[model samples]
Every structure is written in structure tokens, then in C-alpha cells.
Target: MENQVAAASGKLGVLVPGMGAVATTFIAGVEATKKGLAKPIGALTQMSNIRLGKRTENRYPKIKDFVPLASLEQIVFGGWDVYNENVYQAATNAKVLQQTQLDAIKAELEAITPMPAVFDREYVKNLDGQHIKAKDTKWNWALALMEDIKNFKEKNNCERLVMVWCASTEKYIETTDIHETIEAFEAAMQADDDRIAPSMIYAYAAIKMGVPFANGAPNLSCDIPALVDLAKELGVAIAGKDFKTGQTLMKTIVAPGLAARALGVNGWFSSNILGNRDGLVLDDPDNFKTKEVSKLSVLEEIFQPEDNPDLYGELYHKVRINYYPPHGDNKESWDNIDIFGWMGYPMQIKINFLCRDSILAAPIVLDLALFMDLAQRANMSGIQEWLSFYFKSPQTAEGLKPEHDIFKQLIKLQNTLRHMMGEDLITHLGLDYYQDLVESL
Candidate 1:
């Protein structure tokens, strides 16, 4: 494919739709990273290495060094929130970062006050805030979001901008007739159709404005056919459904490892406790369903029971999330995995991971924002399936099954970057190198 967008230079504005815990942690983390206070640890684009040749060649380079990603210093952060607090206050409320960390970047964090949110109580029933847009119709709300994007770009002198949803997951909305086509969606927006959720409006505004949109929450967002068509029409790259973090992250990592070994999993039970706005919002059954779908699909796709019936046909996977106030953004997950191996002997693996939800999510937000911006600059548009490593239920081009294996997803992601820069892909066929070694031996 011929490249269309220009190379990434100058400032890149990352406009988030929600300035809650995940969003604030992202902003703070970026600021800290720029100041050398913290490394972009979890961000694969920033911190990981890629092998560019056969294993024996030893030609591994940092992925960022290989690809032309936006530098941490050149990223500008802005967003909207249902609460009026700035990044500093939001981070404080999130309690994900320490007072010392917030104090260190106080000036930068406090300056990033959220623009009023385009919120709907109907979509997210658990959240209530006075800082939401008063305009009732979804169309007006969408227009306001577009204006916010334009103003943020102009104000920050950004050469490019991308919007990522870091907000609470809305109630589940299946693909209805209204979401079937861009025409019907736009008409629904005009008629103030009740079926159109708040996230879809933000997505429409982003795609209409030629900004790459990524959905971090599992709400319908840009996944529907209508938005997908609009994104392609506008020639913008879009990705997501949910950020793959915490327990789901573990499940994806472990499930594949087990499946690779041809182990039979009889049952897998996952339960988590978290105390954040996301947690509270997910306390509602409707919102949890949105999250549940995103979380549950990983095992099914990874195991591929149809292909490996003996190993995975009887797998029972259950996920539960509890709102425990004491945890407060610190999500703790316990997984009980029952497996049999080597003559059908049953074994169990119990993993208890105490993780910070927003902290885990924050770097993913950074990586997605920066990479999506890079994809735009590299002229790659429409459904960034290569970014599936960072998401739970990754959005893909129509008729394509989402790949769920973390390692394969990583290879796809890295290979896409290498391909973008005209580098050779590593296929792990190192016969020549090993052959020479054997002859010498």
C-alpha cells in the first residue's frame, strides 16, 4: 500500500473523551515519562524490542527505534470529563499515583482541565456529574465534541490529533438497523434516536473530523458497521473495543501458553475486586455485560474448541467483577484454572494478581494514541487490527476473525510496524544460520 499521510513531526495532540482515572493516569504518566521521572514501562511501542531477522542474527532493535513513533516529549494531552476537575485533581481522586508523583508534575497536570463531557445518564446509569453537556440530542453533543477536538488541536499547535475513549463503559447496544449504515446512523443522530449511545456520537464526531478514534471501553463505540464505513470514508485509522489489562491480560497470556502445550482446561474462574468509577459503573448489570462480552471472548478465540476439541471443548470460563471500595482503582483478580496434562492428570493453577487498573491501562492508552497517530502519519487507515495486542475485543475489518493469541498478535503488530518502514519481516525460519553452525560443528 502506498503511504498517504505525512511523517509524524511536531506536536501530536492526544484528546481523550473521558478524563477519569485511566485518562488522568495516562496524562500523568506521559508527563512523568517526559521528565524522565518514569519510564514508559508497559508501552510495547516505547519499551519493547523487535527481532528483525533470524534468531541467530541477533538483530533486535527497540520497536520505537525501528518505527517513526511520536516522541514522548512531542505528545500533548487534552480531554473531556463528566467531572470538572483537572488532571491533577482527577489523579488525586483516582489515588493511583502518590502525592509525591502528582506534586512533581503538579503544574503540567493541573493545567489540563477537561472540556465539558458529552455525557448521557441513560448510557452510564451509575455516573452523575454537573459538568456534562446540557444539550440533550446526540447530534448536538457530537458537534460539541468536534468543536472540542478542533479547539484542542489549534490551542496546542498540534500537527496531528487522535481521540481515545477512556471513559466508563456504557450499557451494551447490539448492532441494530440504526447502526447498520452511516446514513441510518446519521439520520438517527438527527432524529435524536434513543438507540444511539454517547460513545457512538464521539466516534462519529472523531471520524467526521478525520481524527483517528480508538475505543478503550467496551461500549459499542466505533465497532459498528456504520462507524467503520465512516472511518474508511474519511481515510482515518481506528481501533478498539476494550483495553486488555489486568485479569483479562493474564488470561490471554496464560490461556495461549496452555493451549500451545495441548493441555486440557476443564474450567477457568476469574473474579476481580476494584474500586473506581469504572468499577462502580460496572456494578450495574447492563454495564457489566458490556465489559463481560469483551472479557469473555479471549479464551474462546484463543482455544479454538472447534480445532482442538479434546483440549478445549469442555472449557468452562466464568468472569465476575465486584465493587470493593477499599480497593479503589487497585484491582485484584483471582483466577482458578483447572487443567489436565500428561495422561489426563488434573492440575490447578491459582493466580492472584493485585494490580492497579488505571495504571495498567494508562500506558496502553499512551501506546494506542501514539501508534494510531503514527498509523495515520504512515497512511494506514481503517481498522488497525495490528493493535489487537493492546485490546481485549479488538475491532477488525468486516469478515475477519479477531486473533487472540498474545504472541501472534505481538508479531502481527511488530511486523506491521516493520512493514510500514520498509523493513524485512522475521519468519523464525533460521535453517540457514543453524545449517552453517552444524556444518562448522
Candidate 2:
């Protein structure tokens, strides 16, 4: 009883909406890996393995071997960016990787130039670029993007394509009346409503074209009911709202361990300093609110404060990000956690993480692009909560809370893969072998 998944053959084009540091870094890394210069370190689809049977059966296989995924050599890269620099120049400007490393694949990077991007200053107020689409109605811009998609697919000869939003966070936007249905959304686009952000326009174009779209920003880009419904109607797959990296990544990993141990958390104060374009975009209070909401939601869902009032109800969590040019793409984060145990005895946990922001996120871009393509081939569409392991605020079905624990997210991810291949699901409740102890006792 295997799921009917389409064959992963032919060239697969990975399209991105923004070709900034993160996007350029991801492109450069993939090119470097193809040339045998470096390994894709953080991507699970490339590096992780899956178990297919019971504990007694040694059937662990690399995920790429188990699942039909595109090979590194079979990938073709194309994207749009407000800054029209080629990937090589963009990667050099990013300063996330060394000049020597980039020079090794200079020709390959330089050959990939970004197409004009759809941007509005209102959504991201901190920066401006000359390489943007001409001012026009939102509906017109989306049509132009659809044309771009068609041209890219034909030029690359891609049998399949997926859109991963490696872009800046637009200002926080709530789902409004316009976002309730595809018809209302199209009307808003035609009317040039201010609420229709550029990211949504890209998403609409991709999903309407039956392409899978994965959002790596905190903006409610493709998470709205309208887009979710559109994805289902078009038989396209979509997943979104922020790549989980740095501080929030650590929080999801640690908070779950705390909850498992029943540790009573009082306060968790987290702060970050980064000098990338992301840090600057987030410096704007409006944009920061979007990122902050995504980061803060992890602890609450992981802790389940409402379910265990005494352990987590009084929790105080604050998150901050400051723009510091000196840090460049190397972001630093500090977390101060206060917990109580043994009749209210206080204990403190402190963590200082000096991490490269793009370095951690580049692999996420890779994994999502590959996984979203897999989802579409497997006939899965709409909100992809199983792919929630890579996001901070993953989109779920309406009225459903997102799962934020990294361990549980990993399990769900693995189980999804097993299910797709018709392998037995692993439940980790292997005490049946000990049944003889009950009779002996």
C-alpha cells in the first residue's frame, strides 16, 4: 500500500523571491557542494537517515536514498531580488563566506543573475533598491510574475519547480476580509489594496501556476486561508511563516527538554545582535513585531502553560534583536533562563551562541525546497505541518496549535517519510518483550 508519488526525474528549478545574503549563500553552497568543495551540513534531507522497521531489523537508510529527491547535480537555480546583483557579487557583498571560497565557483555564481523583484517600501522600510518592478497594480505584478515562472521553467527545462521565499520579513499583517477567499484576494489585488504584500503576490503567482511555495519569512505570506484554499484547489503544496534559526532554534530544542523533565520555568530573556540585511529590516519596529511574534510563540506552545499552570503559567518571555553592523552576518544570541525546583529553589541557565545567521539558514532553504517538491509529488497539498521542523511559526490547519518541540517535530517528520514509502511507523513503545516479567512477578 504505497502512496502514489510522482517520479523525481528531470531538472528541478529552485526559485526564490529574494536573492539576498541568505538566498545567495544557499545558492553558493549548493554550487560548491556540486563541485565537491563543501558539504551541505545542516540540511536533513541530505545528511539524515531513516529507520524502516523494528529495533531488531537494521534497516536504516539515508533519507535521499529512501525518498525520491532531486540530486545536487540535477538542480538549476533562479530567483528574483530587489538588488539585481548576480549570485557571485551578492555572495561577496554578503560576507558570510570567504572571498576565496566564492572565487572557486566564480563563473557559476556570476552566471546566475536575479530577475527584477516585486517590492514596496511600506512593507520593509529600512532599505531601498533600484532593481524592482515598475509601480503597477498588484494584480498586474502577479501576472508578470506568472510570466517569469513560465519563462524560467522553459529556459531551465525543469520538469518540476518549487518557490522558497528567501526574502525579508514584511510588516506584521493579520488575515483580513480580503484574505478570506481567493476571489476576495484577487479583488484586493486588482484594487491595489495596501494589505496585499509583495510576498503574497509571489505566492499567488506560484500556487496559481500549480507550483509548490515554501515561505521562509515571518510575514503571513502564504499562511492565510485564501492561499491555503488556493493551494488545495490547484493541487499545489505550501508551507510557511519563518525559518527557525539561532535563538529560536535553541529555545525549541531546550524548552522541550525542560517540559519533559517537568521543570518549572519562571523567566526566559533572549537578546540578539546581528549586522545583516535581516537585522536591519527587523530594526523597523513593524517588521520586528512580525519576527518577534514568531519567536515568542515557540516557548508558549512548547511549554503548554495553559495545561500546566503551576509549571509554566507565570512564565515571562522577552525577545529582542538589535542592529549592529560590526556583527555582519555573524549574529550573537544570549538567553537567560530562570527555573525552580525542589520546593521553589531557584536555578539559572545561561546560553551565549555566536552563530552565522545565513550559515544556519542556508540549509533550511535547501531542505524546504526539496521537501516541498516531495510533498507535491506525493499528492499532498495545503498547510504542510509535517514540514514544521524547519519553521518558527509553522502554518497549521485552522484552530489547530502548531507543534514546536524539536524532538517531536523530528519524529513527525520521520514518520511522514515512512508513511509515504509504506514503511511501518515507529511508536517507541517497545515494552511487549518484557511481558514475561509480569508473569514471573
The candidate that achieves the highest TM-score relative to the unseen native structure: 2
| Residue 412 shift from truth in candidate 2, angstroms | 0.4
Question: What are the clashing pairs of model 1?
Answer: none
Q: Which window of 10 residues has the lowest lDDT sum in candidate 2?
A: 430-439
Would you list the C-alpha lDDT of every candidate in the order shown? Answer: 0.89, 0.94
lDDT score, candidate 1, position 146: 87
Please identify model 2 stretches exceeding 4 Å from their true place. Answer: 1-3, 436-441
lDDT of 2 by residue, 1-441 (tens): 255988889999999989999999999999999999999999998999898887678898999999998888888999999998999999999999999999999999999999999999999999899999999999999999999999999998999999999989999889899999999999999999999999999999999999999999999988898999999998999998799989999999999988998999999999999999999999999999999999999999999999999999999999999999999999999999999987888999999999999999999999999999999999998889999999999899999999999999999999999999898889988776577578788
> How does candidate 2 fare on TM-score?
0.98
TM-score, one value per model:
0.97, 0.98
* True-structure Cα RMSD, model 2: 1.3
Highest lDDT: give the candidate number.
2
